[model samples]
Target: MAVMTSRFADGLAVGTNLVDTAEAAIRQALAGLSGPPDLVCFFICGDDPDDVGRAGQRAMAMVPGAHVIGCSATGVIGAGQGVELQPAVSAWAASLGDTKITTFALETLRADDRFVVVGLPERGSDDQVAILLADPYSFPTDAFIEHSSEALGSLPIIGGLANGLQGRGSVRLFADGEVHEEGAIGVVLGGPVSIGTVVSQGCRPIGPSMVVTRAEDNLLLELAGQPALARLEDIVSALDEDDRELVASGLQIGVAMDEYAERHERGDFLIRGVLGIDPEREAVAIGDVLEVGRTVRFQVRDAETADEDLYELLDAHVERTGRVDGALLFSCNGRGSAMFGSADHDALAVRDTLGPIGVAGFFAAGEVGPVGGHNHVHGFTASILVFSSQAAPAAGA
Candidate 1:
């Protein structure tokens, strides 16, 4: 049987224009449905939190029975350059044929020993993949993933942390008609459905790999027996003026986790932001929690490097999937206009490389995708979930 899918988009001004625009968009999406939809994935963006909630409610009202899940974005993605500086909403509805959908939400996720995958009627022991969304501000995201891996027992988790404009104030997450804060939610797809994921790091390795001979929490004290900061300075000095300037603006470091092999490639490294440099101590602080005796490398980010890296990753995904019915993107909020100097760069790349498919997603605080067979929180990355229909089962089992 064919996997059925459809997509829709709506945009409006925030103050007085929200209701009208949202109503129109939701109606248009509902009208195009071939039949009743099983799931409705919505994306909303606005300057005000209240308007975002209103748009989410409008979407749920349009499709009462379908499972509604979405999060706020710094910018929303649609057919064109995403609706900017307005209360806008875009939604995609899917008629999941024989697929089982499971969803769960944990408010105090940090304290829980196990996470229950909700929405599915009964839990099965069979292998499953989870598409997760978390509020980065509340949960210790790293710990959550670690504990989830333990609880789920190697089940692959893919999705991103919901983000607001400029990474300050409150962010919004919607389920049904309600908006929540400081929580994580996800959908577990089991049965005949399968998910293909792609994580585009959008960066190229610049320097030689070094071993972390010494370190502390979130700080790299030494690399290859030399002070971490000293090594970073040496690498930056070797680069040309333009590249050096980019490094100085905001440098990043990648640490190879346990899953990666000795010979790591472009996407193998887990990228982390350089938090600060302690000139006196000669230590380098990173965004991630660190430990001693880890492998590390210095990396650079630029337009050319990012574009090349993204294209390469997407090209591989296209080759594997052959043809896709729909795509769900979890792109970093820092990447859109902040990195590309324009919007739709990441979405356009997916469309161009992966062929025309139903694409919908929101910009996230931290992008999520598997690297070296384990999921990690990433920045300046685009994580894609491609969906395709499965073959029908025998008539008489």
Candidate 2:
């Protein structure tokens, strides 16, 4: 059995006044803990940039001694519920005891024809974890994450793309009380803390896997020596009417992460969106780059499948870890009511299965988490960073 303590807590406030809502949420989160937390994370959703900035500052002031990092979001989740496309504030805090936390900011620059991500620190150790929040429009999150395997080694990087209602479409990133209009913000945690991750690409495979015979950087030209569009047409023709309707709405492609695996299962493939098709050239465009010889499968998603997928993954994590004390959930903005046609589906699932653990998160434009031991920017997915039983017990436990 796992012991529970007040080491971690979360709060959620919903209203039109952003600053007051932020303070209320922070107060609620701070109430359970004995003293100031070691780390504080917040997510705010609102239309006014000025209000969002002020609210972020107030939230930081409430926890003056802790390292703070967060960003504006389309929706905020906490207190066992999710607030979608509304004005809300969510706060999460942790008393990590002696854990070491370091905050950072990153920006991108273009050198000739290449895009370079600057401001990444050297990996501290083999056991550290990184939580990052980036502006989708300004930061090269995909490129930065693709190279993290080499740059940070085995250190797991988790978090997501911040979405804001700013007039210019740029997002706000918060680090240590200051709000940044561009780049990314994050914290690297080492020492007595451990974070376990679960990335649920809530889709089910629809047909047999096919080998990519020809591709051009996100465009699948041929599969098994046949035009990609032709293969897709055949697959769609064979599916039942309901399944075909799903494909017509939002089709997905799963790229096998390991080619040598004898069989690809649910967790074996990196799911990407099927952007569009080129009927003239008989090609299918996907969200990510595809190399020839990779196995690909057609996938479909719906509210029922998504709900089942998230709960199943959460159950597996609890089975392995024994308990989940707290968690940070980064779900894609495409989720929530947009996908599920209901509020709090993902957030409630976590609380219901994990047994009332503190959890907070936001509906990110794109979620970041490891798929097949590698980090990738994903869409229509839920990526959760779980602080397990390994967290140091509350101050005097």
Among these predicted structures, which one has the highest lDDT?
2
- Candidate 2 has which clashing residue pairs, if any? none
Candidate number with greatest TM-score: 2
Backbone clashes under 3 angstroms, per model: 1, 0
Alpha-carbon RMSD, each predicted model: 5.1, 3.9
What would the per-residue lDDT of candidate 2 be over residues 168-241, giving only the tens digit for each residue? 55477899978998889999888887568888899889878999999998899999999999999999999999
lDDT of 1: 0.68
lDDT, each prediction? 0.68, 0.85
Cα-lDDT of candidate 2: 0.85
Clashing pairs in 1: 103-118
**Predicted structure 2, TM vs. truth:** 0.94
Q: Give TM per candidate.
A: 0.86, 0.94
Candidate 1 lDDT over residue span 72-100, tens digit each: 77766654244544566665666666667
